[model samples]
Target chain A: MWLIKHIPPMAKALICFTFVLVITSVLIWLLNPVIIPVLVSLALYVCLLPLHDWLTNLGWRRDMSAMAILFLMMFVVLVPGSLILAEFNEQAMLWQSKASIAGQSLNELLGLLSEKLAQWQFHIEVDQLKANILAGLVKDNGSFLSSISSLVMSISSSLLLVPFITFFLLRDFESLRNKSLNSLPNKYFELGWLMYFKVAKQTQGYVRAVLIQQSILAVVAASGFWLAGFDSPVILGLIAGVLGLIPYVGPALGLLPPFYLVLANPEVGFDAMYTAVLVIGVAYLVDNLLVIPLVVARFANLHPLVALLSIIVFGNFFGILGMIAAIPLLAISNIVFYQLLLSFSPKKFTTNVASFH
Target chain B: MAGSPFWQNLFRPDHKQKKHVRDLWLATPIFSGVSANQCQQLVNDMAIRRYENTEAVFKLGDVGIGTGLIISGSVRICMGEKVLAQLEEGDFFGEVALVIEAPRTATAIAAGDTQIVFFLRPQLESLLSRSPRQGAKIMQNLAKVMANRLGSTNTLLEQSHVAD
Candidate 1:
């Protein structure tokens, strides 16, 4: 105990840092099944903190306020969400019925493309090419269908878990925070609280800003798609909104789905494809020009390279969700790292003057 | 604490404990003028920590966060080998840190098993934003405490000068 107390504060800090990191890693591993839902709940809690605070200030009990806010969240999110899902389901069934004709048209289109390329001295076998493409798509489709069942299961579980986690978090998070912080040695107690508050404040701001910006972008993109007469406009807009959160490549990735749909359906004109391109371009323009400036003011301070690396790394590990979460997570990590590093410096104090000022 | 019904207790396990602490805080210098409801709002996020005998609550040169009220036992404020003040229950120290991010000027060590309730800056800021009236009363009381301490120190310096 004496030796521990005598250790340099920085050394103690480093030990504590490593201890927290290890505990977090182990907890993440242990809670893997419910991790996504927990994260979603936490993000929702952050977004709704102001509302909850307002309710509590109105003399509402914490439990009752949390319950009311949870219901509000469910109504706001689920109503629109269910409508979009229903529209998407109808569109998906229609597309499924048209798959045979679409496949025939796609083959014909590819054959014509091969001939055009051959005219430019880029000779290729259309039959072999079609076979390979069909094989790859079939493989992907099989895997996609297999994954859907698991996705459904995960969603079902999250439906039950998100509200439960969010409710408890809203009601008792402060008490939980205080209890955990009390375990810190008195020396680091202040540091812990400072770090916790700094991290929480920054994270809450960034998450709320991002959610707001994305929702607006989704609306803009969906509106543009509807104006351009695209199928599954809501779904496409949602994807574009999510993808737009990524830095450089998001807009291009957002273009792929509508373009692919255009190619699969021969009856859809090239004019619709052109309109899709123009609409996406304008949608992203609004996002960069209006939404970001108005909602977020400044983007995360990460270098383009860092943002790209995070997107690639997270995308590789966790796929689309990881890609979507990467920048925010990186931004948060930046804030945490900055705060922790700043804490290590000795606090500055002014000297006492002889005369009262 | 155990007398509450199961649901209420489940939702707020520390309800009784918090009420007891709030009553104690009402007597502290910083909360002297604050009403019960105001005190409850102000102390909503205060944490009670227990320290064993002879343990250092904080040391000189450490960054101070906010004030701590001695809920039980006693704490001795010291600078090096000097015995500055012996504070018992209901006394509070480190109030200056609530207004400024400064290193502690002295160390405080527990005389025995001591329980202290901390009102940190974040909670104070939160209170200020949520209910300015309560926040202003506490801040006013804090200023008075600091002023009283400064007046005493000035008097002591003048007495020493005369003796010299």
Candidate 2:
């Protein structure tokens, strides 16, 4: 007891940090199954909360309002999602055949390029390079296909639980929040309340902005591709829009499918490839110049480097879903960490300020 | 009475809690003229906290973000070593903090074992966003409360000057 009481403050802080880390890791591991649904519900709840409140203010019952929102989601999101999945599956099969044909063409193109380069005295092993590239592509695609199927299975199972969880969250979120707040001890109450408010505001704004940005990009890309006479305009547009959720490298990745399509189809011609590139270029311009500045940048406000690093780190841990969620998660953590520091070390913080002054 | 099951059941309030909380909100000045449904919505955002005797509700210089309504006990508001006021059931303190981000002007301590309901600023902002009319009513009431406090403070100041 004496030793414990006499422990250095730095040691005590280290112990506290370790304790919090262990607890967080354990909780995350235990709750991994439900985490995605719960997080999705939270995002949905933040987006829909104003509507829910308006309905309740109009004298509609809480349960009734929640039900209305749930039905609206089913019609607006779920219906269209299913349609897109169906279209995407059809496109996937078509692409599988086209991919083999494209491999052959790629080999021919590489051979011609290698011959031209040989005239310039640049030695190149065209066949070996083609074989290595094709094998790598096939392996990557196989892994991606397997991962996609497992992801779908997990999502389908969790989708069943989402609506139910969302309803309760919408109906009872205020009470639940209050209950949580009431449980905080006096020492932590102010910090907890501040952190909760900041994190919620930041996260809700980020998610709302991202959704709006994605939707607008999808529509614009789809329209541009369709007007340019690209086959599977909707599929291409959807892929572009979805991939655009990743910052920095997403737009470039979005260009690949249409580029591959142009290369694979002899009928598409060089004109079609140029048109595809132009359309993607226009979309990229609109995204960076208009949608991002007006809709997303104000809310996200993340440094480009931070956003890129978060995508890499989160993508490593959670794959595609992690990459998609990285920005908002990083924003929340930043707010929480800043608040924690302000709250826990006010004296030291004040002393530093005083010294500066 | 503390151990009596009948008393416990009466106080426990399983089914009637919502109605009870709504009624309690209705009796408060800030919630007056608000509809029962609106009151219920407000009540949903309130947290009920229990404090032991002599426990601090809030300390001077702490960041204040909400108002606390006395529910079943008394609280003493103090500045430095001087008691400013003793508040009882239905009285509220720190209301100005709910509307503005600032530090607590005084410390509030429970005079006895107490129950208080808190109405936090974020919830109030949400209420304003959802229903401006209801939010306006509460804001108007809050304005009146502040005006009344200012009037009293002015009178005290005037009296002090006259005495000097």
Candidate 3:
């Protein structure tokens, strides 16, 4: 106890930060299943709260208004989503079969190239290389299929959980906020409440802006692909849009499917590959120049390095979902950290002043 | 009398205590013209604080962000060593911070064990954005409260000048 009492303030702060980080990481891992749904619901609640308030002001009961909003979401978002999912599933199955055939063709092409090089006195193990390539493709495809299935399961569960959670959140928002604020010790109460509002505002803006950006990009990608005469333009565009959730590298990933599709089809020829590149290039340009500058950049407002590092760190731990969640999480943590610094500094300065006196 | 129902009722105030809080908020001039639902909503965002005897609610020159409504005890407002006023239940203080960011002009110390409810500026701003009509009413009410305080201050100044 004496040693602990003798520890420097900076060291104590560091210890506290490390303890909090470790506990948060453990809690996230343990509550992984519920955490995503809860987070998504919170975002939805923020977006829908204004509308819910308006309705309630118009003399509607809280629960009734919440139910009305949920039904509106079902019709406007979920029903169309179900239709799109059905169509995408059909296209995906077809693409999977075609992918296997394409893999074989790639193996043959590699073999032919290796043979041609051998005639020039360069020896290469074409068979071994082709076998290895095929094995890798099969393994990758297996993992991809598993990941997709898991994603679908999680999404379906979220669909059920989101509205249910959002309803309660909207109805009890004021009381819930009060309860949370009241729980803070009196010394921290005012600052804690301010931090909460700041974090909420930042996160709500970020989530809404991201959703708008994604939708615009999806439409742009679909139109570009369709105009370029790509097979399954809708699915390819949707994939591009979804993958575009990752910053920096996302558009590049979105470009790969079209490149592969063009390369694998002999009838389309090499010239079509340039068209595919042109379409994706245009989409990428529009996304970065227009959508990002106007929407995401305005809302997120993080340093590029910080954004990139967050994506790398979060992606390492939580994969694609973490990559998508990284920006908002960083924004929230930034607000909380700065507010804590502000709140603590005055106390520290007072202590120093007293010591000097 | 020890086992009487009235004794039990006196010791344990029922859930009607919450309603009493709502009624108290309703009677405040700052919340004038607000509907019952709006009152309930406002109350939901407020937090009650308890202060021990002689405890400082806030010191003079400290930065503050909201006003405090006295609920169950008295508080003494002071400027340095001089006591300016003693306020009891239903009275509010620190309202100047709600309209502007400024250092507090006076210290507010609880005269006894006291309970106060805080209504923060940010909470009011959020309410404004969510419901403009109700927000307008609150702003108008705040203006009236400030105007009345200004009038009283002018009267006090005039009386002091006459004495001089």
Candidate 4:
């Protein structure tokens, strides 16, 4: 009798879990095409809202101010960013070509060694294992470059689309919010709006803080690279800025490229390696010791494990945008999803704050 | 103040309960008779505005479109390019336009990097409709303001006559 009673609850929980997972998967898959641009526009709108509020206070006409800010974004960030990205495109292609040659040479060398070792060892699987490892590495490099280039191309093509949507978003933002809030079922409107604001405030705060950390790291890393006698110092710096977005693994990944560039050159090899290592050290200390705790910790209220998981899952579903946005979106979803789960059932969670606005 | 953790705050389920505008006591002659509830309602309805130093709020005759509540900042209310008054927190102006739905008579500019609460005409209309008692108190407040302006005009006229 006791087991029977609990079975229903267990079954209900399983059903709910399946239902949520299905819905989330469907939503992410269906929204895949427009997801990135929409997300980028969302971020742009959020970052610029403070400026819009300032201009409104100055009593500059809203339309005029919004338009001016749009142009400013293009001039100050996007255009220069695109030009720099073009250089990265060329560099990425060059790196792939060289890395492929190196990879193939290494694979052949390994194959010969594995074959010789297998003949001598009598009954070993060395050759097969070597082949598997070589295949995996080759597959990874090819896919990585292809995916990155496609992303860059898509971003550039859709670049014009962002400002148009962003301007409208900023312009009609408040009125749209009011209408949406008011139109919700009367019983839910106030709570829903409160939740909306809370999520927005938290997400904005986190992104702002993280972006500041990225910029500071970018400058510091770039300066280190410049001093290291690296070619394309500015480009390396810009790359550092973008990589700085990826939290823990970003700095580590960033170290590889400069390290390789140094390794490839004979004259500046050891010195370059040492400098790149130093750059990563300084960057890591700045981020973890001071920046992460002081800046990102306040805004991004979720724990690091949660942050990392969000990036992995979201990136799996939505690619780059997911990678950039996983933390904030997860934080928001954690609250909203938990609230929905609780309200629809009698099982209230201990951490009510996670879901309650 | 970057990266500041959120300080805990007590949540008021209903902000309106905490204020009664009519019971207000302040140095400004304009709000003398208003109730605490009315003042609170006005504060709730007030729109936020912010500006940096040397930023202009509005140009003269740009249709004094909305009322302002000096929420936590200051500004210069100019008339035909003359510096008519420099107002600070708790001060309000351009209210006449919202009352009568008229073009702005003066351009209010920010004297320094400032923040103000703006009350647009349509929003004010909705707010007034929401509370008739508060609306009446605001009308009374407006009458006192008009009387003060008239008394100032009369004094200016008397001084001009003496100079002549």
The 10-residue segment of model 4 chain B with minimum total lDDT is: B3-12
Order of models, best lDDT first: 2, 1, 3, 4
Q: Name the better of 2 and 4 by lDDT.
A: 2
On lDDT, the stronger of 2 and 3 is: 2
lDDT scores in order = 0.72, 0.72, 0.71, 0.60
lDDT of 4 by residue, A271-328 (tens): 5677888887787778777656775556566788877787778767756555766666
lDDT by residue for model 1 over B4-55, one digit each (tens)? 2222213434567778789888877788777898787656667677667787
- lDDT tens digits, residue span A109-196, model 3: 7777888998999887877876665453333643433344345447655676777788788888767677766666555566666667
Q: Give the runs in model 4 whose Cα sits over 4 Å from its true position.
A: A1-31, A104-142, A263-271, A316-320, A338-357, B1-164
Candidate 2 Cα errors over 4 Å, as ranges: A1-28, A34-40, A109-138, A141-161, A294-296, A347-357, B1-24, B147-164
TM-score of model 3's chain A, to 2 decimals?
0.79
How well does candidate 4 score on lDDT at residue A36? 64
Estimate, for each residue in B44-70, the C-alpha lDDT of model 3 and write its tens digit. Answer: 557777777897888655556788888
* Native-interface RMSD of candidate 4: 22.5
Per-residue lDDT value at A247 in model 4: 61
Q: Per-prediction DockQ scores?
A: 0.22, 0.22, 0.17, 0.02
Ranking, DockQ, top scorer first = 1, 2, 3, 4
**Candidate 1 CAPRI category:** incorrect
TM-score of 1: 0.78
Report residue A109 deviation for candidate 3 (angstroms): 8.6
**Docking quality band of candidate 3, CAPRI definitions:** incorrect
What is the interface RMSD, in angstroms, for predicted model 1? Answer: 6.6
Task: Give lDDT for model 1.
Answer: 0.72
